[model samples]
Structures are given as structure tokens and as C-alpha cells.
Target: MNRRHFLQLLATLGVAGCWGSYKAYATTSSAKARVLIIGGGAAGLSMAARLNSVLETPDITLIDPSNEQFYQPGFTMIAGGIYSPDEVKKPQSACIPSGVKWVKEKVVSIDPVTSKVKASDGNTYVYDFLVLTPGLQMNFDQVEGISRSTLGVGNAHCMYDYQGAQNTWKALQEFSQKGGAGVFTNTFTKLKCGGAPKKITMLTDDYCRRNKTRDKISVTYYNASKDLFDTPYYAGRLEEIFKERDLNICPQHRLTGVDTASKKV
Candidate 1:
């Protein structure tokens, strides 16, 4: 059965109780197992699903802060105006298997030796096995002259967040309307979903073309790396696209600061 139908049947029969008993037996037997998974993102959820499908019954607890789960790959499409935010977002409850315990809270600290984790809500979770899939945190504040609060507000926009993706769409639309040179920069640091920056840039270019502002607006992409993409094959293709569109690509150029008032980078 599909996931939705399985969830409906589980809910109708209150199968969560049966799973609780299974969890107890697994934890108590000589072969008992208790798995605690952290982050509940792509990796964590996929692991849980695989384990659940193989085992007759599984003891799994997944910890995540947000009830809303996002397909991060879709963020690139969202920035490109190819998909809506809602299309990329799914309720965490839907992805979580019924048999697994889902904790909605942030992990504050981890005691690896004891195999215990402490959450922001003061709950202590212990397990026989621990799987950590917490993703890297972005430090936008590290960008000089850019404050954490200024993101998605003023001349700054990043697709790291859903709102940030919408902000980028808005910024591109406004720039198209005003008609000016727009500089899009990606830092030297390894960013999640590396194609995201160029995706936005291309989308902006497409928008300008559609609005008949292509000549008035100049698009430049600056990156510390020498290539458009990490992979040679993809970089070659991207270079061709950039050349065809007359989009300027500046390699080995890193963004130091943004002068929002002067509208220069």
C-alpha cells in the first residue's frame, strides 16, 4: 500500500500502541535494540524507512525541530520559479513511520559515551544505537556588512531558507522592473546544493528576457572557484550556456562585502 493509505490504516487501528509493545520487547530481549536517530532529514528518514522495511518490527526514535519537512532539492526549483513553496514542503508527520516515535524538538547536547541525548525541552533520550544526521548550519552572519536579520529584508537574499527563496524571486522581479546590473555571488565555502546560486542567476536572466529588459540588465556571477561547476562535464555545459546567454562569469573572485546603498558588490 501507499504511504498515505498505510498511515490511514495505522491511525484507524491505533497501531502505535502495538508498536510501543514491540519497542518494549525489542529493548528487553537479549537481541533487543533501541535506535535513536537525530535530525530527521533526508538521510535520517531514509535510513529509518529502510530499517523498518527489513526488520519484522523496529525500535526507532527520530528527533527533529520542525514539524514541516522540506525537500531541499526543490528549493533550487523554487528559486527558479519552477515550483511553489508548498509543493516542496510536506508535513513531517507524513514522512515519519507510524511505528517510530517522533520527537519534535531540537537536540541541545549529546552524550555519546552514554548514548544519551538532551533536547532543548529538557527531555533525556537514551538508546542502544545512535545515528546522527544533523545537517550543517549556515553562517550568513560571517558575510561582512551583512547581519542575520537583514536577510530577505533589504538588498540581501539567499535561498538557504524557504522565505529566502521567495525573497530571491521577489528581488529578481524587482530588479527586472527597475532595470539595472545585478551581481550574484557565491562564497568560497562549500554550500549545500552547489547549483542553487546559478539556478537563481539563470532564472533571473530568463525573467529579464521575458520582460524585454535583457539589454538593460547585466548579469554577473562571481565565485572563488575557477570552474562554473565542480564536475568537469557539467562545468563545460554551464560555460556553453553562459557564453550563449552573454552572462559574465568571474572566476577566483570572492565577495567581501556588499554596499547596499551604492547597489554594488
Candidate 2:
């Protein structure tokens, strides 16, 4: 849905991100309304907490199946061995806000027309209002010849998931020891973090340099976009740095396939 429609829907229930305004009005205006939130990630919890804090008596229920909450941005750091995997993990229970009903379940499908949500438990929940923040999914299968099973094999590696990042670390250590060409590529899609590809590339480059394998290791960056960064100033500086470091950058080229058998992309 568009931003205007999304805002109008929430505004119908007098829901606003601002705690002070919501507290001043929503409690008196919409306290009795039943609110069900899908997903227990940062956005979902923050929304639930704000509602719980502001409502005189919140009727809020949050549904999420995850046993643990992850600090996703730290995946790159984990891949580089800069931070341990445990540092990014926390029990989902600990992060959930107080005064809210928590249901450890996944949503099978949502029937917006019927104001119903069907979950993994085979139950339908009806709500006066609903919020969804389940987060993003990576579609590795969309790339020709690439599958989830292909990761951490040969030169194939990614740092998007916790296990994938840890595995990438292992592959990186071995690759660095016997220096060769390493390819770092970005997909042409709305990825979780825009800076993630660049971070992974630079981190790998740093590791090679520190290990005195810079001359032996050739790092090539394949950027789907023409510019390194969307912002002009930063993009200019990044380009300069890449040139100084003698890094090869192939812009406007997206990775469409993975040839795992031949170890090519």
C-alpha cells in the first residue's frame, strides 16, 4: 500500500508514532479497540511498547515465531570475525515489552478483506486494528543456479544471515590464506541495508591487506548501481578510496546467476 493509504488506515484508529500525542488522545478515543500485531522484530516491539505505554488499558497481542531476536546489522562484523555471533543474539522473550500478550506463532496468511489473520496454529484472529513488521526475506533461489544450499561452498559466501555470516568467516580465513580473486557483488533490489555490500567488500579487503596478501588477493566489486553510494559526496570519496586501493569496480552490473559447479558467478 502507498504511504498515504497506510497513514489513513492507522489514523482511522488514531494511531501515531508520537507517544505524547497518542497518549493524550488514543487512550480516551481508542482504548477499547483490540490491536493485533504480526512480527516481533524491532519495529513490531517498538509499536507494541508505545501502544502499551500510552493506552490506559491496552488490548494488544503480538504474534511472532522467532525464539531469538537478532541484531542483523552485526552480521557483517560477525563475518569479519570482528564480533562473535553470540553478541548479536538475544532471547526473543527478553526483548518483548511488558503488558502485551505475546503469541509465539507465525502468520500463515492475512485476509485483509475479512479483517482476519490465519496463523500457523490454524486459528483465525480478528482485530479492530493490525500492524505487521515481520521484516524482510532473502530470495537466494531467484538467482539462476543459486540456492540456499550453495552458500559457503567454494567461492560462494554471503553475510546476510547469522549462520551464513559465521560460515562466510570460515571461508574467508581459508581464502585469505591462499590468496586469489574474490568477488563481492550487490543485488539490484531493496535489500535490508544499502551499505552491507560495500562493508563486506571493504572488510574482506582489509583482512587481506592486514595478512600481507593484498598483492596476492584480487578483490573485485560488482555494484548493481552506477554509483557506490546514493549520496554524491560520499560516492565521490568512496570512488577515490577504491582507486587508491586499486580495487576493481564494475558498476551497473548485477549478478544474475551462480555457477557453483564451475565455481563462477
Candidate 3:
């Protein structure tokens, strides 16, 4: 079943866990299973929660260095000025489900042969079951002439991180107020969300239109692939939207080099 349908069924059945699923435990031996989870992101937290709810006696340890856990999907909303920074920000302690131990540290290295992981604090963790849900990494250094130092300096902005999204919102507001050419492009690297840039671009255009400055400013979108979307059905609709909105679309224009001095990508 689809996720929506599954969730509806869960709600209907009144399942006991957060998403509507109950737990069943039988009294037997005092045996317990050791579960070691890497990364405290969404996937890892979900796995930990589910296992904690189901397992009779589970020793679950979740490892991550960050104290603040962010809801990254809401970043686009922040960039679009639909949400504030506080809305997407949350304490990591709030997401840890029942019976899961939180280790506030980074993992230095992992040894699969010995089923052990070394933490930054010079401690080793040995596990019986390992779940690795480390999220994807952003390679800001991959772009030429642009380092972490130059972000949010000028009209240029990025929504990949929390501060970047807030800065992007400000930059977009400034650009929307002042008439100028607004250019946005995507990278060829595997990103967390492929449509995030496009969504922000469309939102910016809409914002400009609402402010009555859209006619003075030009918006252009550059994509790494030739197609707007992988599926033909959605691609055709997106192309139609581009035509209707008079938005410029440049296909197969991946970002290779950047002139950070001029704020050109």
C-alpha cells in the first residue's frame, strides 16, 4: 500500500506507536538484543523508534554529534518565506524514541569485521545489530572558486543548509524588490532533493509577480539534465507551466565552475 493509505489504515486500526502501531511482548528469558544505529537523522530515528517499540528488550544506541536536529524539508519553506527558522529547528532530544540511548558524538571509524565503531571521544562501540542511516553529505568544495567562506555574501544564495535558507530568503526578497536578472542552477551531484531548486525558483517568480516586480526582473533556471523531470507525465506539465509563466529553462546546463569574485555561477 502507498504511504498515505498505510497511514490511514494505521489510524483506523489505532495502532499504538507514534504512527499507529501497537507492541506485543511475551515474558520469556531475560535475553536482550543489542542494536547500534549510526546517524540520528530521520531514517535512523524511524528505525530506532520502530525497533524500540517492537523489540522485547533492545539495547539501542544512536550515534550523532549534533545536538540540534533539523527538519530539512522545511528549509524550502523557510527560503520561500513561508516558515521561520524556529519552525524547522528542533532539539535532538525530542526525536529520540523510548528505550533508545543517544550518544552525542561523532563516529570516527567503523570496523565491520569486529562489529565495532570508534567514536571521537576515544570510545569503542560493539554491536550485535548495526543500522547505518547516515544521511547524504553536501560537497560545497566541489564547485570551483566557491568555498564555505563566500556563502550569503552578495545576491548569491543557497538553501542547502539552515543559515543558507534564511539568507536565501533575504537575498530573494532583495532581488524581488530590485529589478535584476535572477539566475539559478543545479549541480550534477546526487542531492537530497532534486526538485528543491526548482521549487524555490518557482516560488521566487511567484513572489516577484505578487510584488509587481516580475516584469522588471528576469528569472532563468538551469538544470543538469535535459529533461525537466524523469517521468514524461510530470515533465510535460512542468514544461507547460514554464511556458505559461514565461520562465526560462535551460536544460543540460550543469554547474561546473563558478566565479566567486563576481558572484557568478
Candidate 4:
């Protein structure tokens, strides 16, 4: 639906508290509305909390299958050995607002026409207003010879997943000790954090440098875009730093597949 139409619908349902203006209003009354949130990630939980606080009697139902809410930004830190996996995880039940209802089920399909959603448990949910905060999903299978189950195999690791971040840490440690060509690349499709590929790349570089193995390793970063970064303010300086460090950067190179057995991408 269009933004205007959606806003009008929310007003019709008595949920006029927009996120932008929610902070300005005090909760002296309750809103008679049913808000159905379809995710339990940061966005979903945060929205649920805001609604619960602004509305005294918030009939909010959040549908998600995950048992834990993860601090996804910390995943990169975990890969760099700066944070542990447990540090970035919290129970989903604890994160949800006290009054909000939590439905621990994945959404199978959503029928906007009927204002109903079908869950994996074979139940349909009717809602007055819907908030979709479903987070990104990684498609490792799109890359040949590399699936979610085979992460860390042949030193192929991605920091996006919890276990994958830990595995990347392990691989980084091994790489630091036995220096070799370390390749880091960005995916062709949109990703959660654009700077993550650069973060892990530079982290690995610095890791080897601190370990006194900098000379033994050759690091190369492959960028799907022609520019290393899009921000004009920092791109020039970042390029200079990469050049100073003798880091090989190949632009417009999108990773299509990988050969885990041969450690090739």
C-alpha cells in the first residue's frame, strides 16, 4: 500500500501515534488498536517497546520464530575477536515488551487484501494495523559450493551468522599464524552492513600486523562496485590508507561462486 493510504488506515484504526511523533506525546490514555508486528529483530522489538510505552493498553502481537534477539552490529566485532557470541545474544522473550504478545512462529504467507497473515503453525492472524520488520536473510546457496552448513570450510567464513562469526575468528587466528593470501569480497546483492567487508579485511590485516606476520600475508579486497565506498567525505581518505598499506583492491568484481576444497573464490 502507498504511504498515504497506510497512514490513513492507521488513523482509521485509532493508532495515530506515528513513530516520529510518539516521543512528544505522554501516555495518559490507551489506544484501542491491534498492532501486529511480524519480526523480533531490533526494529521489531524497538517498535513494540515504543508502542507499549505510548499506549497504556497496547494490544500488540509480534510474530517471529527466533528464540533470541541478536545485536547484529556486534557480529563484526565477534569475527574480529573483539566480542564473544554470547555478548551479542539475548532471549527474545526478555526483549519483548511486558504487555505485548509474542507469537513464536515464522510467517508462511501474508494476505494484505484480507488483512490476515498465515503462520507456519497453520494459524491465520487478523490485524487492524501491520508492522513488518522482518530482517534480512542470507542466501549462501546462491554461491556455488558454499551453503550455510558449510561455513568455515576451506577457511570460507562470513561474519553475518553467529557461528560463522566465531568460525571466522578461528580462521583469522590460523591465518595470522600461517600467513597466506587472504581474500575478502562484497556480495553482488544488498547486504546488512556495507562496511563489514572492509572491517573484516582491515581487521585481518591489522591482526597479522600485530602478530608480526604482516609481511607473510597478502590481502586483497574485491568490491562489487567501482568505488571502494560511496561516501564522498571518507572515500578519498580510505583509498589513501589502502594504498599506504599496499592492500590490493579490485573494483567491479562480484563474487559468483567459490571452490571450498581448493580455497578459491
Candidate 5:
């Protein structure tokens, strides 16, 4: 759905006060069903909001470590030098519903039998229902000879996070000045946003062209996917753009390792 339609749906659903009835469910002596949500990311918060709207005063608790709520899609723009760090970040308090209890802690372990979760802060919470929305973990170490520290410093970099996006912007700026070839690689992992990798690459290419250093710098895209884009229509458009710009595209090549010393990604 488009942004306007989505916002209209949210408004129609009374998202703001939808959780008032859920609070009643918590206070009612009938069952006192406790709902525990793991992870305060988009999925977790969205689930919490919807449940609150359906049930009256529902007993729900959201657990997460970070205090800031990030709009991940904006990271691509940040890497493109279109947005600042502050513009993409929001206080967690602002995104979370008012009635739900916000727990600032990390989940250490889950005892499914007892319906309890242990936190890193030496506390445990019990729940009648559990929702797991903790986002997937990125294993940069899986790449041979590449450490987590190699990103943004060495030849390797990714724009998956805010800090990483900022680092990518810096890397692009530096690369523009030095006029060297760079490789942007994307694996076939289940990433949050599939289009983000190419978006950043295209933005970097645009940046180089704008700075009149396009000839000095060559950006190659190594995507593990079978096609540049999944959808046929979008793929055709991308193919046309790539051909028009003469951007190097490598399809179906997975990233194995980064040769930092040789700068061969």
C-alpha cells in the first residue's frame, strides 16, 4: 500500500487509543493473560499496537535494548548523503504505544515450558502468550578473512545500520577524492530491505558522477541473486539504467571473502 493509504488505514483503526480496551484485559480477574513480546523493532511494535487495539487493556510488555527507534529504510538515504543521523532516528518512547509497558533489557534465555523469559538484567517475566520478533543477526564473521571491524575501515563496508551508513557515506566521500575502483557486494541472505544494497551503490555512482570523478572511479555490483532485481518490470528498468550508465553488474556471484590488502572485494 502507498504511504497515504497506509496512514489512512491506521487512522481508521483508531491506533492511538486502540489499546485502552486491552488494559481492561490486564485488570480483569478472569485470566490476566500476560503477553510478552520479544524485540521492539517494527514487527514487535506493530504486533503490540494491533493487539492493544483489539483487546481492552491487554497486558503486554515490549523488551528491547536500544532506546532509539530507527527507520531502517532511511539508512539508504543517509548513505546517499540525503539524510543525517538525527533525521532517521526517533526516541523509542515516541514509537511505542503509551499504555504498553516498555522494558529496556536484553533477553538472555527463554523457558518455553514455564512461559517465562530471563533478561540480562537479572529479572524474569512470565507470560501466557509470547511473540518473538527479534530481528535476525548478521554474521559478518561468516565471510572468510573478514572481521566485524573490517567494515567501514578496510575495503569492506555495509549500510545496514545507521553507524554503518554514516561510515559508508564517509567511505564514498573518501573514494571520490582518491578515485579508485570499489566493489559493492550483496549476498542472498534474508535482509530486511532487498533493494537497499543497490540503492546505495547507485547513489554512490551518482555521487561520483556529480563530482566529475566518474571516470576515475569504477563501481561494480556483485549480487548473489539471479537477476539485478526480482520483479521483471523493475529488473527491466534497472537493466536499462545500468546499460545507460555503463555500470558493471555481476549477477549470481556470492561474496566469499574480502581481500583487504589488495582491495579486491
Candidate 6:
């Protein structure tokens, strides 16, 4: 069944718990609890907002080292030339909800037994409740011959970071004009947005098509799993679309390293 029909079925069975069906029941609490939240990203900030709405006198303190907040989902669109770098970031101070304390410090260590957290500023914070929402980290060192500094150096670009996204946009423009082979890959491990690799690959294909250079450009997609998408409903359709678009799909292959000197992976 299609997604819409499946969701309809869920609603009929009274199990539809989608975001659209969610209703917030805001009620202020009298407890003056000190809540310490680690990280200032979307998850942390959103949680703080919810708590602030539900607590009459919220004592929420958010700790993060970054001075700027990034809209990470926009990175892929930025690489696709749809969003500029400036549009994806804003000062972290502007994102922190009012009535919430912002601690501009990196968390060094957490001592759960003592209910305290040691920050980089050589200060310890005590909290009645702790919320950890620290985001994921990208380890370029794990991949041999490719480091963060080497991105965009040899047509090697990624959309996971701000600079990398801009570099990818630059490389894509050159590639679209030069009309060469383009390869897209994904890791075997779970990603924050696992469909990003496929999305960017399709975006490149679309971009080349719009530029009227698709025929000269060969597109190959390497996936580390057995299927392009784990969901059978969409996987079958995606494979069909890839075939129709002349996009090569190779499954069960993981990219371990890159040989930028010889243009090999």
C-alpha cells in the first residue's frame, strides 16, 4: 500500500501517532528544578522550548561551545546550489529561547554519581536533572588519505559540514560543465539522515540534466547496504527510477579511503 493509504489505515485503527496528529497540552509546573541541558543544536533547543512552556519558572541552562547554530538539513540543499552558506547559520545567542540560561562552554566530563558536570571553563555545574543532546561527530581521520583539511582539494567534497557543502557546490559546477564521471557513496553505519547520499546523487543528476550535460556525465552510486532504501515500498520504486535515469547503483560497498592523487577510491 502507498504511504497515504498506510497512514489512513493507522488512523482507522486509532494508532496514528504522526506529528500532524500531535497536540500539545501546556501546563505550568510549580517545581523550581534546575535543569542542565548539554548541546545547543535543534534537539537541545527544542527540548528547552518545550520545558520552558511547561514550567512557570523554568531554570534551564543550556551548555554548548559553538557561537553559531547551523541548520544541518540545509547543507545538502546548499551543496545542490539551492541554499547559500549564510542562509544556513545564525548566531547561537539568537536561537536560545528567552528565560533559558546559555552557558558558552564545552562539556569536559559528566559525573552522574555526583550529579555534576565539569565544563571546559574549569567550572562545575550541579543540576536537578540533566539532558544530554550532544550531536554526532564526523571522524575524517578514520578514512585513510582523506582528512577534513583535504576536502575540496581533489574533487573530494562532503555536505556534512559548512565548508564542505560550499566546496561541493563549487566542485559540482565545475563537474557539470566539464562532464566527467561522478561517484556518490555512503557509509555502512547509520547516519543522521541516511537518505542524504541518495538525495545528493539525484540532485547532481537533475542539475546536470538541467544544464543539458547529463548525456556526457556518467553517474554511479555506491551504497553500503543491500538495498538503496530499507523500506521495500520505496526501494522498488527508487530502483526503477534509477534505471530509467541511467544511474548505476552498486550495493554492499563501503568507501574506506580515497586516492585523490590518481582520482581513485
The lowest-lDDT stretch of 10 consecutive residues in candidate 3 is 21-30
lDDT of 4: 0.84
lDDT tens digits by residue: candidate 4, 130-238: 9999988899999898999988888888999888899999999998888899999988797999988888988888888888999989999999998888897777788
- The residue-level lDDT of candidate 2 at 192 comes to 88
- lDDT by residue (1-265, candidate 1, tens digit) is 3445434333333332344333332321112367788989897887677556534557889999888889988886787778898999999999997788899999999998887999999999998767788987888878776765687544778887788887777777788889887788887887787888888889889978988988888988997799989999999999999889989999999888776666566
Report the lDDT of model 3 for residue 198. Answer: 84
Q: How close is candidate 1 to the true structure, as a TM-score?
A: 0.84
- Candidate 5 local lDDT, residue 87: 96
lDDT of 6 by residue, 3-75 (tens): 4543443343233443323343233455567789999999899878767766667889999999999999899
CA shift of 48, model 5, Å: 1.4
- Of candidates 6 and 5, the better by lDDT: 6
Instruction: For candidate 3, write residues 157-189 as lDDT tens digits.
Output: 789899999999998898888778888888787
Maximum-TM-score candidate? 6
Stretches > 4 Å off in candidate 2: 1-30
Error of 6 at 81 (Å): 0.7
**lDDT score for residue 39 of model 1:** 87
Q: Model 5: how far is 230 from its true place, Å?
A: 2.3
Worst 10 residues of 2 by lDDT: 22-31
Per-residue lDDT of model 2, residues 34-72, tens digit only: 789999988898778766765566788999999999998
